[model samples]
Target chain A: MHDIGVRETIRFLGLTFNIETLKMTWLAMGIVILIACLATRNLKVVPQGWQNFVEMIILWLHDQIDAMMGRRGRMLAPFIVGLFMFLLASNLIGLVPLMASPTNDLNTTLGLALLVVVMVHCLGLYFKGGHYIAHFFQPTPVFVVINMIEEIAKPITLAFRLFGNILAGEILIIVLLKLMPIWMPIPSVCWLAFSIFISCVQAVIFTMLSMAYLANAVKEDHAE
Target chain B: MIVLIEINATILAQILNFLILVVLLRAVAYKPVARLLQQRSDKIKGDLDKAEADRKAAEQTLEQYKVQLADAHKKAQDIVDKANVTARQEHDAAVAETRKEIERMKATAQAEIENERNRAFDEMKSQIVSLSLAAAGKVVMKNIDTKENDKLVNDFISKLDKNMFADLR
Candidate 1:
């Protein structure tokens, strides 16, 4: 934990980075990729064993994306699915002792939030063009400032929401682990299960919200 | 005493970090994983398509079998109908043959009866002729001479008349 808190640690050839989060993130990413590759290696029309299960998950994600984004969801399926799997894996990796979730750090969450915001704006501009900017000035000119403030608040809210939830869960588990020695591991176990559930939920929620924002931005002519 | 300094991440630093992570993830993780998923989906779709094709072919084969069965049934019905017609024609021919045989027997029997009646009539005619001649001869012999012949003839005529009258009565 002390080693994790200490920032700007460099070891080889002056490549200074956050040690714990970066390492876990890489490891999680590698695991997801490896699993995907291994599952799809001998692709058959009638999937057997692990490939069949993995295909079900992908198809399920496809349905969720379609539900959230409608026809355009198919286009965004790969990106959102990839993001969900990556985040879920990273979050679950934190459950292991001595491993920190990169998402628990503000930097990672902020980065992801900003990426979503930028993509949202880009899609809005691409789809709606000049009309997209006009959405902020709706009802009255005064509302434009409010809309702008809300847009600015989005990334801050997104980052803190994820970071705070994960960090708090981790801290609570740590505390519980220390407070009760005999039955102490029970709470940790429960917390671990809960954290896994919460991580999956958060990933889905985050992707769903991002898709909604994009969908809202991309609506062409809302005259009424 | 070591003082803990809080280092704020600059926008440039954050952006650089973000780009690096994105690039790394894209290269090492996201692309490969997504590609694998795409391949799997393609495989599944291929399998589904094959199954659908097989189903359609099976349906077509079933239809063919049904059509063939129907044709076979129709042919069987036609054969049965032909057999019934042949049986009916043969029955009618046999009845006509029986009727012709009865008509020939009736005609033959009528001809035999007519011939028997003609022969009986002929025999009766001959007998009557013979009897008449004998009566004439007896009258002539009993008279013997010239005057008595006339008288005998008159008597004979009178007697014949009486007899005729009696027969008539």
Candidate 2:
């Protein structure tokens, strides 16, 4: 129980690696890859079994991206779908005994958020050129600072929202298991069930926010 | 909170992980799946078009057969009519030939009857001339000249039998 709060930190080439988070991240990646392989193997024109299941999830994600940015977001589908699978697996993995969620680590969540934000700006620059950067100065120079703050807050909120929820839920579970003796299994079980629900909700919220941010970058009309 | 948000190499590693995953997954899954779906849709479109063409060809062939059937019926009817006309002509020609033969037979029989009656009348005249001559010679032996009596009897026979033979004719 004491070891639950501690991460296995490793030093390699003068850089500290959070090995525990890395291990869980790799496990999540393996799950994602396994699912991808299963879905794509022996693929029939008429889908069945795992192919049917994976197609349903993928088609839903595609519809979301398509609805958000229509045809322009077509290229972004792979990255978006991959991100969702990773997030979903990372967030839910903590529920298994002796395992922890990779998303509970701030580094992992921040890394994902930064990746999305950077890609959004890159896509904006690629599609719209100078207007992408010029949007921050719209409605007069007075609004530049506000727009800049809004831009900075986007990734911060995106990262912290997911990290905080997952970490807090895991921390509570740990707390309930270790200290709470008044009402033992009831609260712990309830919180665990609730945390599972929270994990799913948080993953979906992250994915949706990322899509929305990306859509804004490639939008038809610049509303800034 | 300060310790938790520390910038470290882990963030870089995680980004690398994501990038590698994307590349691998794209190769294994996305491109192939999209292509397969496109292939199936294209195949369906081609099949449907071929089916429509086949249906149209079958219909055209059926229409041609129907037309051919109708023509055959018309041709058969024409053959029957021509045969009937030829049969009627043959029947009429045969009847005309039979009537001509009958007329010729009747004409020949009547000519033969006329020739036989003339021959019988010639024989009777000869017999009657001989008998009258003999009878007159016996009756008037020394009373008249022989040469004069013969002339008188011949004149009498000619006068008496003249209309009788005419009536018989």
What C-alpha lDDT does candidate 2 achieve relative to the native structure? 0.86
Cα error of candidate 1 at position B128, Å: 34
Interface RMSD of candidate number 2: 2.6
- Span of ten consecutive residues with least summed lDDT in model 2 chain B: B1-10
Residue pairs in candidate 2 whose N, alpha carbon or C atoms collide under 3 angstroms:
none
Residue B72 local lDDT, model 1: 100
Q: What is the C-alpha local distance difference test score of each model? A: 0.70, 0.86
Best by lDDT: 2
Tell me, by TM-score, which candidate is best.
2
Tens digits of lDDT, candidate 2, B36-103:
77788898999999999999999999999999999999999999999999999999999999999999
Count of clashes, each model: 0, 0
Which prediction has the highest DockQ against the true structure? 2
- Docking level for model 2: acceptable
